[model samples]
Every structure is written in structure tokens, then in C-alpha cells.
Target: MVREPSDRSSGPEEQEGVGEQDGFQRLWTPHRMAYIKGENKPSGPGRDDGCPFCEIPKGTDEDGLVIRRGTAVFAVLNLYPYNSGHLMVCPYRHVADYAELDDAEALELARFTQRALAALRKASGAHGFNVGMNLGTVAGAGIAAHLHQHVVPRWGGDTNFMPVIGRTKVLPQLLRDTRALLAESWPED
Candidate 1:
């Protein structure tokens, strides 16, 4: 569960932009501005016309990018990732809707999805994972097509003033290394 910040005041004015940033200069970072704008806009990857996540990149490097690939399923790094270990397992057949998943494929996906969690945890020693799929385009889904699932690693105290105040995150690991760790540790089925 997302524990609300304890010291925060419970008043609209108090949260006009979110609590005191001792250094007003920290908010100048572009990432924070975009984050603030995103909060107001409430849009994500799907808004991009050249949606990379929708179509499987044919010639682009998938070795470090694509963490794993099965017959009908494949896992890739989320280009605009939530965290270092963020990944998405997508179906080969291009279909926007989630209800299109067949029983067998869906079942395998469930099993593999569990594997994704296990592998990420094994690789990163992540405290936990946030696994989910955004159903419709309106639901913050980036690709909208090719049903996929997200696996985001969560560590204690991932949230800090950096984002709220400084607009940054101190990611402890590189995405490439994370890919290698998860790919290597993932169980073969």
C-alpha cells in the first residue's frame, strides 16, 4: 500500500505544489517540470505518434533491450521506464484488446508473469514488484496494442524529496545490467 507522507499537512493550500523545497532551485530540473506537467496533463507514452512499444522493433538491438522471448510472448525494457527494472511482456500477435488472449496463452502468460517477478527480485533483490496492465488507451497504456504486462521493482524509500522536491531519482543500477541479471536468472520453461 502507498503510505501517505506522514508530516504533510492536510490542506489544499499546503499542497499547492507539494511541500516546502528548501532550495527552490531544485525544481528547475527538466525532469521535475515534465513530471509536474504530466501530473497536470495526465498523459503517458500512447500520446506519442511514433509509438515504439506498439510495434516490435524489427532491426533495433533486442539483446539487452529484449529481456526474454518465447514463442508467442516476449519481454522488453520499457523505453520510458518507471524504474530501472521496469519491463513489459508483450504478445507477438498485434492486438490492442486484452480479452483477445487465448486461454493457453493467457495461462502461460500468468506463469511467465510470475517468473518475471521472481527473476526481477532475484536479480535486483527488490523489496517487491508492481505488476499490472493498463487495459484501455485511456488507462495510461502506452502501446495500446499488443497486450503486455508491466513488472516494476519497488525498493523501500523509493519515493523521496528528489522527485517531489528535486525531481530526480537515484537509480542504484543500470538498465543494461538489470536486463542481464533478469535475463540470466529467469527460469527456462
Candidate 2:
């Protein structure tokens, strides 16, 4: 089934050079410009020095993209999630190392991770998950000054050719919606 390209004059959006297109489909992700431009990245590691992990919890959960708040730790959506429901468990303290975490912070972090998985399972029907920490910048910690564990949900056939060949991730859900759903489903413990 060969579908011919429509005449460019049909609509302003279809005009040549108005937008880039692939033969099959398009994934326009303009919001990523902020990430690419490093818009909200912190200047330093200080607790009040603009680090996102440190500052995020201070705002309303919805605005901050936070899923749940614990005594010493919190769970929040990954601003630049690899998948739609990607989440991170982080300590409230501005400590960088996992070893730096006090017993309570460490325990709560673990609990949050568990709860995040449960919430995601209930909210999104996740088949599997990739949960771990990236210790430092060299090890893939986008925000290395704060200790955080990634909780990326996975499903069968989730990894497609776009990420492998085009270096692009296709997230089907909106971040705020994903956050709201997970927050609603988060265990009350």
C-alpha cells in the first residue's frame, strides 16, 4: 500500500520545510529543548543551591512531579524519563553517596523504591522494572550531587528501533499524567 505525499499547498503545516517528517510517522518532542539546553540544572551541590533533587520536594507534588513523600526520602518522576513511568527514589538530604545515607534515609529510600514499583504496576501494568542507582556523573547520574535510585518500568517489546538507531525515546504518556496516576496509586505506608 503506497500512500502518495499530499500536495504541499493543502495546508500550512504540510508546507515544505515547515516540519521534518519520516516516511512512516513523526515523534515531535519539542519539550526536550529545555533538557538539551540544561535549563533547570543546578549550579552547585548545596541543599539550597538549586539542585533539582533538593528543590523539587519543596513545591506542590504535582508541580514538582513528585509521586510520594516519605519521612526521609521521596519518589519523583524522572524529568527526562527514559520511559513514560520512569521514577527516582531520592533522599531528602543533599548527600551524594549511598554510603552517606543514614539508616533512616537508606531505609526510606528502599521503601520508596518498593512502593514506586507497586504504584507503577497498579497504574501502568508494568511487566518488569530496571531499578538501580547511578553513583556519579561518570557512572550516568544526570544529577550526581544527590543520591537517587532509578525505577524505570519496562514491558515486553518496549525497546524498539527508535532508541537503537535514531537515539530517540518514545514516551506515550505525559509526565504530569504519569505522576498523578502513580501518586494516586502509591501505597499509603
Candidate 3:
């Protein structure tokens, strides 16, 4: 038998013996919906096919959350970060693999990674770091069309039950603010 939902008032107190209150409080994060829905993720593997790494370099530093711009690479904050100061060093050229990078690109990418570590340490007093690349989708690269190396800053006991059990990471600062701080802390060449 098909039963129709009653047209009763939906308020918590107004509900008739339904939706019993639990002790848990909701930490509603509506912003995560965009990521969950894959809103800006690339539709195809081409540079012109909605690749964020290609598009990010075209905008101003502040708008793109870019910390430093080298000749062949740039450092930008991860839109969906694992930690507070997580950023990526990406080659300007939209190549999928690290082996595809030219000599200049590879050198600058390494230099930028070094600078990222220093800047993050100065800006946030990070105790440690998780730095590497997820080469492809199978390797856990979110945007596998472009080559980017992650520079995730870590502090002692940064991981907690929130991310383990609750499946949520609590970032204490905004991306823009973190960008500004890291940019200020970046070493001058």
C-alpha cells in the first residue's frame, strides 16, 4: 500500500511523536556540497576543457589564491585542503605527468616546493609536512589533467577523531587569509 506523508507542520516541537531528538548537534557545512557534487571538476582531460590549473594562472594572485608565481610554476592554495595551510606547486604548462615537464619547469617546481615548506613554517609554525604528488586519478589526484605537487603542512596531533570518525577537517582560517599570510612569508628571490 502507498502511504502519503501527512501535511503536518515540520517544526521539531510541532512534529507528532516523530523525529525524536538525539543528543548529537549538527555541524552543518553547506559549502562542502559543491565539492561533493563535483561542481568545478574537469569534464574532460584537455586544457581547454574546464581545467582549473590552466584557468587559475589567468587570474590575479588574490583571486586565484596564488602565493607565488615563478617563471614555469606557481604555488596556490588547495581549494579543498586536507589541512589549514595545504597548497600545491603546479607547472604553468598543463601536462598530466611529471616526466613531461621541461628542465626549467622541473627546476622551478622543486624550488617552489622548497619555498613552500619554508613559507609554511614561517607563516604557520607547522611542525611537519606531507609533500608529494598524486600522479593520476588512480593515485588520488583530484585534478589529474595537470601536474601538481601537494605541500600539506602538519602539526603535532593535527589528526583527530573529527577526520577519523566524524569525517570532517576543521580549518581554523580562511583560504584567502592563509594565502595572504603565506605570500607575506614567502622568501624573495
Candidate number with greatest TM-score: 3
The lDDT for every candidate, in the order shown, is 0.68, 0.86, 0.91
Runs in model 3 lying further than 4 Å from the true structure? 1-18
| Model 3 residue 93 CA deviation in Å | 0.5
Clashing pairs in 2: none
Across 38-133, the per-residue lDDT of candidate 1 in tens digits comes to 432323434233334444445343433777777677777765577778988877666567788877678767877888888888887889889999
Between candidates 2 and 3, which one is better according to TM-score? 3
Cα lDDT tens digits, model 3, 1-189, are 333445544455434466644434556688988888987888999999898999999999999999999999999999989999999999989999999999999999999999999999999999999999999999998889999999999998888899988888999999999999999999998
Question: What is candidate 2's lDDT per residue for 14-37, written digit by digit as tens?
Answer: 545675432444456789999989
lDDT of 3: 0.91
Q: Arrange candidates, best lDDT first.
A: 3, 2, 1
Residue 91, candidate 2: how far off, in angstroms? 0.9
TM per candidate comes to: 0.69, 0.85, 0.89
Per-candidate clash tally: 1, 0, 0
- After superposition, the stretches of candidate 2 with alpha carbons farther than 4 Å from their true spots are 1-26
lDDT top scorer: 3
Model 3 worst lDDT window (10 residues): 1-10
What's the CA error at residue 151 for candidate 1, in Å?
A: 0.8
User: How displaced is residue 73 in candidate 1, in Å?
Assistant: 0.7
